[model samples]
Target: MQHVRVYTDACLLFVEHKVSWDDARKSCRSFGGDLVMIKDSAKQKFILDSLIFEHWNTQNIWIGATDKAKEGDWRWIDGSQVTYGNFANGQGNNHNTRRFIFSDGSNEDCALIRRSDGGLWHDYPCAFGLGSLGYHYTYACEFTRSGYGTTIGPTNQTGSTDISNHTSSMAPITSTIETMAPSTANPNIETPAPTTAMPNVETPAPTTMANIETPAPTTLPNSETPAATMSNIIGKKRRL
Candidate 1:
């Protein structure tokens, strides 16, 4: 069960479950997408407007972005290059925010959008379980929307799993991805087209016939030789 919004070819579902960053991502992926990746201002604004002040301004939400791959380089779980962000000024990887900095001195690199910062983004440790300040935060999940029509579910207050999927069941999201990311680096590059396969051909074998037996010719020349010899012998006897 989940709540969602369909915008253009994309769908963003606000999952109310209280899971860790990793678990939140897993739950989003369970619906055929990863955590919502807010790629551009338009997308970010869409999320903010959709959430409104009451839902977001008072809380934080997760996005499918992280610098866990390499400290400064953020990436989307869909393997997309980071290109757009709404990071609060001085936010993102290793800025001067204590919330972003862990006392344990581990990496705090997962991304989320906060209502406190006008729904702008902030980075926290991926392991930072539930909410921003030890409170549970609702998360958004992105999905492709080709065959899946756009839909919006009822609001979930407790972030529970009471909302079931309306457009589709737990079907595979193979034809879609809607996570947002930001980078000066090229983002959303299309994968190379797959090579086409050729058809097979067959050749016929040469024809072969079984061997046949032939009858032998009789000897006709012996008749002429014997008749000639008999005439000669008769002539010789008369002469004698």
Candidate 2:
């Protein structure tokens, strides 16, 4: 349930449901606050008196103080040391046996306010009794009043810090543009294939044997002078 009360410098939210200490703190943070931190006696009294008025029948309510970081070195959720404390008699010793272990073997690391003990503090198992142990109680949340507009109230549909109407200038954009798409240009250059065929023009070289051989001898008759010379010489001798 969404119920909140405003005091001097803080706003307290009382969640009337059972949850683990961690889950309780997370719920409070979801609404921009955290589990109530009772740092000093004045804050402690404010919490207790407020719980009394809440009328929550349960005796336990998760607080912000814990020793989860280091055993026996208790500190609030904000990392401030617990200089002031109102732990019940023999309470902050982790457990009854003082071995820092509960009956279920879980460590007592989270703090809570017990209404039965008039809002005194105790270190309890952070996750025990949340499940089968059947231990159930509610938790309270506190938001600093100074952070009212920027970090308070449930989230809205328009995603603005303010609760009522989101300012038009602060309204979130409906669509987003992609600025990192893959490039369409190719990364490698294309190379042409090499030609394999010989050239079309032939060389002037004559490869035939007949064209290269010498001319054959001519069989024409001998010249007439060789034969006439012999006959003419015989006829002249007889006449003489």
Candidate 3:
């Protein structure tokens, strides 16, 4: 999600979500710039062509311009001059509407790019909530041309910066591109798979019961037989 588009002077953070103009400015301020300031048409064209939702699909971004301070006095939140505007054909008209009521009955005064139109700058009340009139807008962040050269993520899509937690230098790093569909070939280069067959292995057999042998029985001689002969001789002497 750490996507940022890099350039020589500044970087554009493409946050493709429903963000209010106020929250959008806060998000940009967290990155060191309070919303992008389109000083001229060149900057505006750069933002329109380079910094956005890839197909950017009618999803507008909130700029730093707002007339909340004084109606029709649309000025940059950083107190810069309001030199140029790329407002839509019918937008930025006499209605310099000051009173605002969000969908949830909230009030805000800010500006936004019209995604439904051609990314034209439009004066809008800053609020996106759940109600009959709730409207949410996507936003982009800008970092003033700093020599630190630090940039947001490749495209700033799904990426965020926590200013309070960071202690490192704000130097921009190399750019990052969004992940595309996995490709089998690049510049028509295809990776070949290894076709080598593995060596054959033998399986062992199962074990069973073992065989045994029995020994023959043996007998010993007796000693009482001699007494029988002495008895026979005594009987003969008696007969004599």
Candidate 4:
């Protein structure tokens, strides 16, 4: 299917890759857009009534609204205050601010459009069940003549799973190093100690040193000096 659909004012790119809210925003931004911001009722209706129902099959989709900057004070990615919110009843309580509700244990700081009740908006945890927790959904990117916009939703495809994979990768590298260090150091150190002791046992080094350094230095200098002196004397006698 065509990934992008153009509108009168903006263009919408429907992405099938599921990811965390942060990852979704990044994906949109990568192509010159942020998450789709339904600023007013017209934009909201266009998405819920037409775009989503027509082109998408997922139940939930992330939006650009977030209260991460300040609890209970939600804003769009452009830092504009959310003036019109079509929130579902009891969904955007903004309760306990940054604290978790032990029942669900997540701070519902980001927004999504859930299609169950005619596609009303709801706040969800930014991280939710994505990024190694193994859950994610498709998202959309909106673009204008000026720039870009973004969103995401449930149940399939790989996007941000690699975010936490570094921790898993570190485990094997650490184990391999630990295994190699001891094996190499122990054999080299222990073998050298025994070989060094064997050299001490043989003790033949003093005799070889005595022959190498002695007699040669003493006899060579004496023999060469006399021969040179005799040659000089013979040259002088011949001249005389």
Relative to the true structure, how large is the alpha-carbon lDDT of every model? 0.64, 0.67, 0.60, 0.61
- lDDT for each residue of candidate 4 in 150-200, tens digit (9 for 90 to 100): 222221221211121121111001101123434534444334433434334
Best by TM-score: 2
Per-model TM-score versus the true fold? 0.55, 0.55, 0.53, 0.53
Clashes of each: 12, 0, 14, 8
lDDT of 3 by residue, 62-134 (tens): 7888776665666777787587877765344334343334322123346677656776776666755433245
Ranking by TM-score: 2, 1, 3, 4
Q: What is the RMSD, in Å, between candidate 2 and the native fold over all Cα?
A: 15.5
Ordering by lDDT: 2, 1, 4, 3
lDDT of 1 by residue, 126-206 (tens): 764533344346788887766444333333333222122223223222333455867668768899988797666666777
Weakest ten-residue segment in model 1 by summed lDDT = 159-168
lDDT of 4 at 181: 39
For model 3, the superposed segments whose C-alpha errors exceed 4 Å read 51-53, 96-108, 128-132, 145-171, 174-240
Query: Which 10-residue span in candidate 4 carries the lowest summed lDDT?
Result: 167-176
Q: Sum up the clashes in candidate 1.
A: 12
For residue 90, what is the lDDT in candidate 4?
Answer: 63
Clashing pairs in 2: none
TM-score-best of 1 and 2: 2
